[model samples]
Target: MKQTALKRWFNSGGPGVWLSAGAVSIAVIMTIGLLAVIAVRGLGHFWPSDVIAAQYDVPGQESHVLVGELVQSEQVPRARLKGAGLPVPDQGPEFMTRDLFKIGNRDISPGDFSWVIGEWLKDQRKPAQLMTLERREWGNFYGYLVNVKEDGNVIAQGEAAWPQLQARIERVQGISDQLDRLEKGEIGAINHGIERLRLRARKLELDGKLDAAAQADMASERAEFDARYKAVESQLAALHADFNRDSLTARDGNGKEIEIGIGKVVHAYQPNAMGTMTKLGFYFQKLWEFLSDDPREANTEGGIFPAIFGTVMMTLIMAVIVTPFGVLAAVYLREYARQGVMTRLIRIAVNNLAGVPAIVYGVFGLGFFVYVLGGSLDRLFFPEALPAPTFGTPGLLWASLTLALLAVPVVIVATEEGLARIPLTLREGSLALGATKAETLWKIVLPMASPAMMTGLILAVARAAGEVAPLMLVGVVKMAPSLPLDGNYPYLHLDQKIMHLGFHIYDVGFQSPNVEAARPLVYATALLLVLVIALLNLSAVTIRNRLRDKYKAFED
Candidate 1:
């Protein structure tokens, strides 16, 4: 009776349903697990880890002390360690443990990370005075405070040096901020004005319209800009002199002391001495810096604000470009075009376009959009900027257009499906009420189909946000000096190269010279990209759900 019941349950499709459910559950669990791993690896990088000072005595190597954060530890087969040219003890078990240390001071050391056999580490202790110096260049410095100086003379040393160093650093930072403003803001504007005057003169000369009056006016404008530039330059020089006056000397574990400019240090903290509250505050501070600051150290350190801005802006542009075109095309095919051979072939082609390799789209975009269309635009509208390429270069505009082309088919298919689901009686009813086909589509049909459009937009955003290959060919760059949208006139500069998170991840993960240093950044960037896509999709999904709710009665 039990066997018969079980067989009957299977025959009734219960087993199939349960099996499908189990498969979906497993898939969901795997995805969650992957994201969890990424989060742990990425978010943990910013935390203030306790610095460990270890005495090492390895055979065939110099006995010395090492100090830094103990980044990771893993057990490997004894044979593997031997194969890798490490001296593994044969008396031990078949496996041996190894620890990776982030021994910073990259300016002094051969590298920032080193792997040591766990057995060779004799005495490991967390030294309270060990300081971690986060710098703007050459990664980080792990050391102890020696002295604080001004004008090459030691003003404070030993314990007093720490507080003096902090005070001077704050003053130096203020000076640095002033220098940045003078250089990038006031000075930058003056330089831009001078360039405009020069261009104006060139244009007038080209048109044979340069008279004495025009020349005098241009000269006066140039003179004004030059005066402003000189004043800003003088201020900058003074700020730099002041900023460079304060310096600090630090001694590493090897007792070698190096003097670093106060301006070069981003932050210095004694991780081992820090209490839980201090570490928490430091962690959140680092996290905020990562999200808000511009990247330094060859895109390996600092914040990814530019990449984040570029990504969000590009996706928004692509959506704006794709939606109207996709909706119009779908409406024409479904409501206007007659059902025949040509229409059927067109439908097949649209479906196939969705499956086409994304790289192929990138190539087509490079050839047609960047080369042909953009070149023509530059020649016609920006003739003075010739040879510099201007619009004829890979930029945000072309990138957005390329992605729009790549994503339009998805939108079309989705909108068409929505239109098809709308019953025939509604259309007939609208027509009987003296509504034209265009009117019906614009008012009734499109409104009901809006939910599907939003669905397509969500899919497009998800796909486009993660895309790196096509963006490389179109507009994305390793580093953009200025963001596409900035305080400059015509603030939204379409013909500007952008830093994208997807491309940033690719560059850091694969192309970076320092692989170990870039690895954690890769995970962090990947997590941020995923979050960006999720937020974008969630927004679209919310709008879609609302539309679906409002339009459900019409469908019924």
Candidate 2:
């Protein structure tokens, strides 16, 4: 009876249903697990970790003090440690515990990180007075504060020095903000004006209209810009002098006293002295900085604001370009085109295009869009900027166009399916009620299909935002300190190169010089990228659902 019942269940497709459910459950579990791992590794980096000061007693090496946060711990085979020339005793356990410490002070130390065998670390402690200096250069400085100085004169020492140092840092920060505004705002505008004047002169020369009057006018503009720049430069000079006026002395783990300029120190904190609430506030502050600041230290540190901006801007531009084109193509194929052998072939071709490798699109975009179309546009319209290759270079516009082309197939297929789903009676009834074919499509058919168009866009955005390969060839750069969109004339600079989060991940994870420093950033950046794509898709999905609900009565 049991065998007969099992056979009956198999024939009823019960096994297949259970197997499918199990597969979906496993996939969901795996995705959640991966996200959890990325969150823990990436988000934990911002927390104010207590700094450990320890005595190192490695065999055959002189004993010294080590200071920094404990970065990671691992178990390694003793044989591997011995092969690496660490004096590991082979008579004990097969595996030995190893701890990696972030021993910052890269300018003075051999490296920023060190690995010490667990058994050899002595007198490990987190002292409340131990200080960690987040710097503008050389990674970080881990030590004890000695005194604060103004110019060459010592003003505060010992416990009093900490508050004095903090006050000076705040003052320097204000000055730094002012200097940044002057340089990037005032000076930058003047420099841009001068360049524009120069370009105008070149264009006149090319047009054979470079008379004495034009030259005089160009020169006058150039001189005006120079005068403004001079004024801004003077302000900048004074700010710089003030910025460099104060300094602080700190004693390192090796008892060497080093003086760091106030302008160069970004943050100074005693992690061991921080309360739970203080640490939480500090964590949020660091996280915000990471999201808002430009990258430093060869993309190993700082924020990824540019990457975030570029990714969103590019994806949005691609959507704007692709939606109408994709929808139009789908309309022609499904609504107007004669149902013949050619129609079926075109549909097949589009479906296959969706499966093409993204790198192929990148190559095509570089060759055709950047070199051919962009070069022609530059020559005809921007002859003054020849050889500099304005539009002919890899930039934001080309990247967006490339991604649009790559995503068009998905949109076309989705819209076609939506169009096909609408009952023929609707179109017939619209025509019977005195509506033309065009009117039927516009008033009766298109609105119902809007939901499907959005579904296609959601898919396209999800795919395009995470695409790194094609963008790398077309526009994405390792460093783009100057954003494509700025306060310059013709504000949205589509021809300017921009950073992208996808390429940032690739560069930081694979191309960074500091592997240990880049690892956590990679995870953090990956998580951010995921969140960005999710947000984009979520917006599209919301629109699609609303459209679907609005047109539901028609379908019902």
Q: Report, for every candidate in turn, its global Cα lDDT versus the true structure.
A: 0.90, 0.94
lDDT of 2 by residue, 125-238 (tens): 999999999998899999999999999799999999999999999999999899888888898788888888889888999889999999988888888888888888889899
TM-score of 1: 0.96
TM-scores of the models, in the given order? 0.96, 0.98
Q: 13 in model 1: Cα distance from truth in Å?
A: 2.8
Off by over 4 Å in 2: none
Model 1 C-alpha lDDT per residue in residues 1-556, reported as the tens digit of each score: 9999999998999988999999999999999999999999999899999998888888787998899888889998889988887766667788788999999888899998999888888889998889988988988899899999999999999999888987987798788778777777897678767766777787788779999999999888888888887888888888889988989999988899999998898888898999999999999999999998889888989999999999999999999999999999999899889999999999999999999998898999999999999999988877766677978999999999999999999999999998998888988999999999888878888899999899889988888788888999999999985678757677798999999999999999999988888998999999999999999999999999999999999888
Worst 10 residues of 1 by lDDT: 481-490
**Clash numbers, per candidate:** 0, 0
Where is model 1 more than 4 Å wrong at Cα? 1-8, 83-90
